[model samples]
Target: MDSPHGAAVKAEDFGLKGPRGWAFRGVGIDAAPGSLIAVEGPSGSGRTCLLLALTGRMKPTAGHAEVGGHQLPKKMSAVRRIAALGPVSGVTDLDQALTVAEQLREGALLQRHYGAPVRAMLRPRAERRAAAEARIASALEAAGLDLAALPKGERTSVRDLERLESVRLSVAIALLGSPGLLALDDLDLKLSDTERAEAWALLRSVAARGITVLAVCSEAPADALVLRTGPVDPDAPDAPQDAPDAPVEAAEPAGAEGDTKNDTTNDDTNDDTKGADDALAEAGRA
Candidate 1:
């Protein structure tokens, strides 16, 4: 059961244009809570532009989008409050010199300051400190990041962390404010295969806990709903194979040693085909 009021992102006929030309056109999608939708395309294929539009960071030249029931203003401040974007470029907002704990504390304080009523600021110092600490702890746990493991525990500088660790820390900071939607771009850009798998697993766990996630990638996991983009006539052969100035390479000899090797290997495999089939049948039934 999805929350009717949960973050439901809808983009209708979205389009964007830059100085050169259109970045994207006629893009439409509806993402509900708990859904993992992937946008897949080649480089310079407008994937990032579509992401920015959906997240409310950039407005579409045509059509409109709504996130968590809030329409994007022609401004950034309003959008900043409802969603968090993790860029594929791995640029976390964490201060390089600040420890993980300090970053979390600052994030909570900032959220409270911005979201708090003016009179709440007038409360006693102890009360504010307690409230901030509670929020930070909850957020860190929810993000699955243990600040205590850092070199200086919560006091370790972000500059000391490995790339993956830094990404996790950024996600923790984003979770502190309880955003309605989380958008990740270029999730596999620079990560190793194993690291990328770990990152995807982490994100799926986050989605299971009820955060709406939309990611952009050149390739996506098997379970993701894929949105693909490419040239309109993808199979058309546009290159001229018979152009007047084209170069040609000589063909291999008919009775070459390579042909003999392939024929011998094929004959040996054919002789074992019956035994292999029987083994495969037994394995399948068992």
Candidate 2:
């Protein structure tokens, strides 16, 4: 079945409340095929939670979401099959003891074993190994990852690699499965300007291949569809004010709609901040 976005994700009136408070309330979004929709907000503004909900990793308290033509709960398995999530939480998903090539090979084998029927699974072991190896190479190349550059090349242990390399490995693993919808969280959290630009280019390339990308970021990219949220004015009374500016402010949505295009362009060109890049390079070199 076709997804709400004609790709593989749809959320309507989705709400999630945590122990602290509501992460997102009455949030609704749709992503069409090949489109990149970005969710922009402050650190604690429920972007990650929303992403989890839409991806079927977390159930919502209210409203509905669909992935891959199946209603959330009813087709969760199917949704998972076609959706890939990359979250930056400092926790490596790869097995630290395993080499990069081993990790990739294992991922491909597992995907095949789970995705195919009993008959297909019964195929000769040699053929299966050949197919898995091919998939691993393709996924790595697509993500611009060069395992051979490591100290031990493809044999390099995950634990020995730099944080950025590990992150790239996770991205390669996610791409190995070829999911129709890709959800990325904190993509530019601590990367250098050059690294972030390269990452953005990689993401754009993935989207160009007809995948829908929904990412949560502190700042939105130039071509992203931006969505923002902020604290509601508690001191200001809800009652209508006589001031003309008050009416205009009330009429406009959060973050100001008129600034969308300008903000996008500004974000694209605002590369003056070299401090972040310096910090990221330090981290990468460490």
Candidate 3:
């Protein structure tokens, strides 16, 4: 189904400052609905900050942006409600203790309560539940997650899921609310060459479905509209070096973090459908 509120993003010399200095500066982006845009840069180059700022999660110091028709740094709240982020450090990380099914169900419930319409709130319990299930089912299908094929099936805990599976689950959760725009961090973080290719294919498929996608990656695909960021320049006169108490930008390192696993391709069957089905059942139980 096509999105009722899909909106393009346009930024003109957009910039933001953090305690350490400018997280990102002089950035520009113009992406249409259903397009794929990549924010490419090294670690600590303020890519994440830029993602947050564009999505209305952070305020910018200079320049301006309009997301989904709302001017950013001003109508940030409106943009935030329409743009969803996943794998964002403090925003959408998975809980290691929860099973895959449990997480999906919880995400759906949260979306129903927080993102659903007033009519949905007043609907009969059964009708509301059916609607939620339909949403989860559609989202899982769209994300291409096969819950059954997971190592432990639907009962598989997040800690036990492989990196790719974890990524799929996070994407599924983000899609639960059907936001017009989706933003993801670390698109190729720990994947091997083959995995990275598969991940890119998946994102491409997403964009083809009419929802705009913004991805943060060390290296963006050839076809994506790319925006590059770099570390703050202290040599600039407006740099925060003179400030006695400027804080540090404690952002994560630029490339593939946390997973010390090898970058070589793994030929593990990409069967995520089974796990996705189980997750639906689990969500229903919740």
lDDT of 1 by residue, 5-55 (tens): 236777665655433334455667777876677888775566655665565
- TM-score, one value per model: 0.70, 0.73, 0.81
Stretches of candidate 1 above 4 Å error?
1-5, 72-79, 87-92, 229-286
Q: Model 1: clashing residue pairs?
A: none
RMSD of each: 20.2, 13.1, 11.6
How do the residues 139-206 of candidate 3 rate in per-residue lDDT, one tens digit apiece? 78888888878878889999998777777788788888777788888889999999899888888888
lDDT of the candidates, in the order given: 0.56, 0.58, 0.68
Model 3's alpha-carbon lDDT is: 0.68
lDDT of 2 by residue, 108-167 (tens): 766665554477578899987776777777777766789778899999988898766766
User: Which stretches in model 2 have alpha-carbon errors above 4 Å?
Assistant: 1-8, 88-92, 229-286
| Pairs with backbone N, CA or C atoms under 3 Å apart (clashes), candidate 2 | none
Count of steric clashes across candidates, in order: 0, 0, 15
Q: How far does residue 5 in candidate 2 sit from its true spot (Å)?
A: 11
